[model samples]
Target: MSLSKANKSAYFAWLKHPGHYLFFKIFIWFWLTIIGTVAALVFLSNITAINAVSNEPLYGPMKKNLIYTAKSIERSAVKHKRTLSEVLVHPRLSKRKLLYLSAAQSDDSLSNKEVPESIDLSLLNFTQNMSPQIIFTEKYQAFGPVNIKVPEGSFYLYEIDINHQPPLIMRFKLMPNWMKIVIAIVASLILSFVFSRNLIAPINSLKKAAIKLSAGNLSARADISVNRKDELGILGRDFNSMANQLELLISSQKRLLADISHELRSPLTRLKMATGLAQMQANDASQSYLLRIEKEANQLDKMIADVLQVSRLEAKSQALSLQKQSLQIIVDHVINDAQFEAKQNNKQLNIVGAVDVNINCDESLIASALENLLRNAIKYANNTISITLKHADAIYIEICDDGSGVPNEQLGKLCEPFFRQSDARDRVSGGTGLGLAIAKNAITAHGGSLVLSNKEQGGLCANITLPLIKE
Candidate 1:
């Protein structure tokens, strides 16, 4: 059967995830194991029962009829050779008898007759070996006395041909039914369901914990099977250790950035003071140089401050001040300021939609992040820029520009600190390359995401998504 795209994708997803893959693997294995074992039991039972029924004692009547007939045929065949052939076509036996007469002489019958081929040749051979005797004596056993009874319909003939003597013939039955064994085996297999559930319960718990961990709940642990001394217990312990280490390392990195940013501020303040002191005694030509030095110093100071803010946001040092605010007011104010700057740079800035909904947010932080996005849009816009906002399950703010989009390879790196798509352009534009990084950190701090993608038509699109507050 052909599968739809969604179904194919879902099947692939199940194979990729460890927990889902493991669950399917165990489920298939358990069912196949039960089926295979039940089938084996049924096969073995059929063999044993067929062998028991095929034993010589069960064919007592057939044995007596065959021996008497065979002795009379032997006695008459000495007078006429055609008598043996005539008697084979119409044997003197019970109405229940159904036998195949062997044409070959008894002296060479065992060597000439090959067993019938079937699906279960071994079992067929076992039953066929239990044919009854035509005559029995202590010194000369007839057809080798055996304990197994043949199945009801199956029969094999034995012929005795001596020198100048007609052939002596006898027949015995073999089994023809095997259904009862199958039904009994299927009934026994139905009771194994409880064992299957017990086997899956621990694995289900691990699957849940794995899914929770993948969804960013780092505290999730596979507590099941941890007490046992088996391989499962080892796996649970290992997973817990890895999660703890990952959490510790990320926490340490954030704390380190915060600490370093705090320490750098003191030296940067002294540098600005030193630059201002040198500017006091400079001549007119030297004053330009001093001003340039001062300008660079101030830019450096701003960059450091922005960097510190980013670290604080990541470390969660600043708590949110969420309050109901007019979305339209915030967007208008940010756009007005950005349009003035766009006009200075020979670019047109406009708003596409007016949003009047009240959203809960940290006004200062969100506004600052929006301003940073606008500035970036203005910086890269060739001639036009636009802003739009909407509220659904979440609030969305999109800032777009008509300039060339960033390279596809560099799109993901845009939010990383100090990541510049073009080093020369970033330097010439007086960009420290931390604007988008800081904006992303701020949005993430408010439980939102800042997405950057290339516009389908042209340029770059920055999307900000924040959850709507429940009233």
Candidate 2:
């Protein structure tokens, strides 16, 4: 089961990564090339050696002979010689039916007889030597040379109807099949593995560089590990150059936003103070109009605060003063503070859920976030608001209200700083559109998230997940 899973995973990775595919392709090609070249060389050498051996005049006119004379033309014993022609054209049934018909015939020629170990010279082509690569095995069943080799003699096994001659037998030595296959595979593996390593080393470096860059190190670069004039080396150099450009561009943008925010703070402060005083000095008739301007000035102030907070969070410049504290205690304090405002609007404030969970958090920031969320819920609720604390992987503080919930499609947009629904009815709430957004930012800074969704029946729900320390 494990091997099957591994095979499946490997196949998927190979399909997804073209580089892996290329590496295996080159490896296989290199292996095949080595095998083909070596096999061809070995085969050629064997054939050449066999030809050289066969070319030697390994036979003489009268090598050896064993013939029994029976009927002769006029009772004279035919010549007994080892020459191939003499063996076939001897007088009497010379242990070979064909030889008998071609010579002095007798019943002896029709049947073969057992004789001492010997080879039939006429059955083999002694005139031309066999190539070394030419197969010679166990007699005729297997095509390879026999184990018992006659180094100085040409031999062949032949069956003949010679009752006066022995059954012929011969043997020769040849290489084994298992040994050849082992040699081929071992040689191929060694050469291919070495070649593949050399070819794939640069690719491995590129993979490491890519991983580093993905892990937020934009300055990560690949070393020019390959010096060969190849496409891979060129690609490495180009990738390094591209990463450098990205790092520079991002740093420049961050600096620009930081500078603009810092420079705008002084003028915004002056505008906010001026608007307050202007509202105080206006006559009754203009006072209402002046108050409108004051509200707009407050909105501006709120947006500026959000911008500064966002910038601080992004720059990682906000220091957290975290401490372990009971989340129930925090919720109680915030609820106590919001109770008066809820009552003024004919709303009920309730905090009902699991309690006694302790959390490691920046107390002031978390309290501020909860306060904002509750206040927004109270403002939107039609007289009823509930703050619940549920326990799970984290402390979930959910605030649901019995008011007309947010527009279903605009749930995600409410968390954007200064983003509000476009309809006039939505803007009638008169907020700077930064309440939910700032709360989200603060929660995110504390390593939490602010989720917005509509209640099942009717209302807006804000679920804040706060990591708590186990008690």
Candidate 3:
């Protein structure tokens, strides 16, 4: 592949990978911070070095002090009739504060072991001009080769004073400031990149696990984080523990619901049989009560079935059997059944727009969800209900009614199981309050969403969005 294509491929791959973007972001931030700090310190150090060099005190009083100390030692030697080298070792002069003495031959050659190894011998060349010259190095400064004449022989006197600058500052001053800054930046980038990766890697794992858990995958875990021995590992372990508890609690709740629903089935079946037998033996006056009992029994049975379905959906016990089906056809089938129900109640049902979209979904679940929503619209609508279908990035099916809209505050709770707007509505509708909940769950199972909102004109509108199958 061409280089550009290869680069594009890698770029796309990085985008597809989890956590790489976060890692890059963190790395960039850390690298910039560290590099900025290093550059600032380098700049400040350069400023200090420049000031120290420009305002150095070595050229004035320090030079005079060296000359004065050398003259005093020379006078002491002449008075004591001792050689210059011998006089240089006298306790009084040798122990002088802030003065270091070294003696050499007049020719600038070392005459004794007085010179320290740290002082470069090449600096003695400054004395050949027969004038006091200052020599600077990383550690200290030397002023010297002042001529000291004695009967024994001519000697050179030198004074060394420590610079008192910090060793690190002195060493840093040896190199160009720009070079040092460049080196510091490079090192910081490398170290920051590694540190950011190590820090964000675990966080990325936790993020992935969290996403999976939120998406109903109970088994997701931060395996990499769990292996670490740091605080992140502790957090990871706690997260896993929480997930485990949640899985157990939800599983138990679903099992309990399913078991209760199953247990009630047998008794409801017996009750229906007994009701049937009673209706056959009862006279005209008792028949009405028996019919009411049968109707209530049927509603109860539906409630139990809805509870079982909710349990199954929550447990993910029912896997979706996906198929490519025409969404228009499914909507039509649901609308036809709903039209008959609307006619019976003297309400009108109409389809406003048409779309021919094929979607990958569980057909039965999608159909059932639509049926529940259409029936809900038929029940609440005062005079007219409308279905609108449109094709966009996904398929949109909107069912609208012309009745009173839900309260804004209570709109969010419409899909919650066993929730009713008011006791009066609950009694009048005789609903199990699980229809919207089941519909929402069923749509979600097929990677679709059901949204309910108040229409601008009047009444509620239920909008369902299903992903379209790509050909």
Best by lDDT: 3
Across 3-35, the per-residue lDDT of candidate 2 in tens digits comes to 688768754575576555667778889999988
TM-score of every candidate relative to the true structure: 0.60, 0.50, 0.63
Put down candidate 1 lDDT per residue, 183-252, tens digits, no spaces: 4345545544455446655665677778887754667887766566776777777877888887788778
Sort order, TM-score high to low: 3, 1, 2
lDDT by residue (tens digit), candidate 3, 404-470 = 9899989878887778877687679887788898899999888888889999999999998878777
Pitting candidate 2 against candidate 3, the one with the higher TM-score is 3
Candidate 1 scores a C-alpha RMSD against the true structure in Å of 13.2
Error of 2 at 444 (Å): 2.4
List runs of model 2 lying over 4 Å from the truth.
Answer: 1-264, 271-293, 402-412
Better of 2 and 3 by lDDT: 3
From the highest lDDT down, the ranking of the candidates is: 3, 1, 2
User: After best superposition, candidate 2 residue 29: deviation in angstroms?
Assistant: 18
After superposition, candidate 3 runs with Cα above 4 Å error: 1-172, 179-224, 227-232, 319-322, 402-412, 456-458
